[model samples]
Target chain A: MKNFMALISGILFSLGLGLSGMMDPKKVLGFLDVTRTWDPSLAFVMGGALVITVVTFRFILKRKAPVCEQNFALPTAKDITSRLVIGSALFGIGWGLAGLCPGPAIANIFTGNVQMILFVAIMVVSMIITEKLVD
Target chain B: MTISSEFTPLLSLSGGIVIGLATTLFLLFLGKIAGISGIVRGLLTGKKQDRSWRSFFIGGMVLGGLLISFLKPELTAKVYEFDTFKLIAAALFVGVGTTLGSGCTSGHGICGLSRFSKRSIVATITFMAFGMLTVFVMGA
Candidate 1:
């Protein structure tokens, strides 16, 4: 049941990506390139998502446990470390260059775009290497 | 760089709301973050019991892409083209960076920010700044 729900959630999330124009790399670039060709659509996307979550998460988390899990697997770390800063900076550069993030990339796998296939393949390998090498 | 004439407000907001709704569903029932990078990493390296749901969720994403291709072919079509070197460079940065940073756009940008985690707030701001800077530098 949990897995089924996950599948449904994934589908819904990808649909949102599609409908919001996030599936387009150019669109994403347009937003990221604030100095030039700025598009405010992505901001709206985050705002819309936040409006629902900022309120809903507070209430949902007040519960003892979620329906399918014994506990919420939330992040506990609070310190702002250099690792976070440097890594995020790198990720941002990548996002700016390609305008594709993990979610949108994965969501578009079945589109048979050779470039996307190459991107995901390299990303997976890079992630594996990073996991092995990094603490 | 020229100003893009394409600015979508209503569609983007509606889509974002739908994305938020999906995350809510995950939180309400599965107690998951609906974070694509984390889910992919977990599927690659997490415990055996955790793999099933992650795989299903990823499968659903592929299925969702396929469905969108049929329903909205224009949305599924590729818009920008990148060279091999740039693509690999970008992918490498994204993969390693997400791993080290512990989240991606979905996890840190959406889920973490909504919860108002200081770590997430810092991460999001850092990435956004750097992203804009990169575009500025590269003139892309």
Candidate 2:
């Protein structure tokens, strides 16, 4: 049941990403290019997502555990370490350069674009390398 | 440097609502944060017991764009105009950064901030500011 839910959620999320133009690298870069011609549409997407999340999350979190699980597997780390800031800064740089993030890049797999494939492959390898190093 | 007037606020809002709904479902039912970076990380470093659901979730994401393209046909477009080397370099940074940062835009920007985690708030601001700076510096 939980697996099904995860699958469903992933699909819905990706579908939203596609429909909202989040999957478009140009749109993403445009949004980030605030000093230049900017696309404010993605802000509405973030705002819309944030509002729903803020409303629903607190209520769901109040329940101790999720509906189908023994515990809520939430992110618990809360330190403002250099790793967090440096890593984020790096991610932002990459995002600005390529306008590709994990979700959109993953969804772009269906495009059959060799460039997307290469990008995703490299991204995965980098994740693994970082995971090992961090551990 | 001009403001773009091609704002699709309604479309973007509906899309965001869908994303929030999907993420909320994952949190409420699966007890997982529907973060793409974390999910991808899990796939790379899999615990046998947690593998199936993760795979299913990833598979769904891969198909999501395909499904939408199938339905709309006209909405299909590719904006990855970067050169081969640049794309690869960016991917490396994104992967490492997300892992070390412990979250990406969706994880921190959407889910983390929603949960009001101070760490995420800091990370989101840092990334966005740096991202803007990078674009400005590179003139991209």
Candidate 1: tens digits of C-alpha lDDT, residues A7-109: 9998999998888888887778889887767888989889889999999899999999999999998888889999999989989988887888898898777
Query: Lowest summed lDDT over 10 consecutive residues: which window, candidate 1 chain B?
Result: B73-82
Q: Across residues B1-140, which tens digit of lDDT does each residue of candidate 1 receive?
A: 45363899998999899989989998998986877888998898888999999998889888887788778867753545676787889999999999899898899989999899898888899888888888788766
lDDT of 1: 0.86
Q: How would you encode candidate 2's per-residue C-alpha lDDT over A23-53 as one tens digit per residue?
A: 8777777788888887778888889899899
- What clash pairs does model 2 have? none
Q: Which stretches of candidate 2 lie above 4 Å from their native place? A: B1-5, B73-79
* Candidate 2 accuracy as TM-score: 0.95
* lDDT (Cα, tens digit) per residue for candidate 2, span B1-140: 23243667898899999999989998999877888998888886968788888998888888887787677533333434567777988999999999999989899999998988999999999989988887777655
What lDDT score goes with residue B45 in model 2?
A: 97
TM-score of chain B of 2: 0.89
All DockQ scores: 0.78, 0.72
